[model samples]
Target: MTATTAAPAWRPAAPVPCAAPLPAVDRLRVAPRADGWTVTARVAVDPRDPNLAGHFPGQPIYPGVFVVETLCQAMAQAVPGTPRLRAVTSIRFLAALLGGDEMELTLDVDPAAPAAGAASPTEPGWTVRGTGRRHDGTVTAQLRAVFDAGAGA
Candidate 1:
């Protein structure tokens, strides 16, 4: 019989403690749509964010992971019940998110899509797709994520 190998599980880098709390969504608005729901959020990057310090000494660029976290936060807030991020299906970063930059994040959630894990239709789960854009409308990133229902509860 031929041997089989399984790919290693994916894991994020170890957390780096920050001197201060990381940036947060300044404003968030949620509106229901016929298709699903729409979430608009704004985040103001702080120059003093500890992540900016060692990220680059001279040139501090916002970490891409932070952008993803921002979108996940928006999804959790917009959706009812406790939602937990199951996986990031895809994400593309087109432009560098710089420190002190103001970013506009938009998320669209589709509850009809298949849920991850063993959650049922009656559960509170969704598939989320979103984009992060600069004030001038430059697309910084596009992401798709799956959230499990009541996982955080």
Candidate 2:
């Protein structure tokens, strides 16, 4: 089943730390590559999104946690099956994404990798590295996450 068809069954088993409702992915694009896949998503910042409130009160910059959630959601929609988030290996906020500032997330996923240092060498896993940037070219965030190998099954 492709991601689109499996959407209803996919849910995050891990507790997402996002303080507000997950951002809606306005657009999703996926391309199969020799190594794995390339996934991109567009997120529109809603000025009234609850995430903006209290995040700063006066200066609402989109929370970094929400950015991570957006990335995870995008990956789930880009591939089949729900990706059980195993670990967020890395996350960095180079710039702030403020209310009404749209951003695009791009991910390069390696789906056939074994879990790094897994107890069993055959344990399946995926490594995703990606970035979020504004339309004007301001790179706002960069992140990496690991997921169980059972996805796309």
CA lDDT of each prediction against the hidden true structure:
0.69, 0.72
lDDT (10s digit) by residue, model 2, range 19-44? 42764576777777557777777887
Off by over 4 Å in 2: 1-20, 115-121, 150-153
Question: Compared with the true structure, what per-residue lDDT tens digits does model 1 show for residues 1-153?
Answer: 111533223222223222223635666776665566767778877767777887888778888888876776666556676466777878999998787788888888777454454335445567778889998789999988877664446
Report how far residue 7 has shifted in candidate 2, in Å: 22
TM-score of 2: 0.77
lDDT value for model 2 = 0.72
- The candidate scoring highest on lDDT is 2
Best by TM-score: 2
Worst 10 residues of 1 by lDDT: 10-19
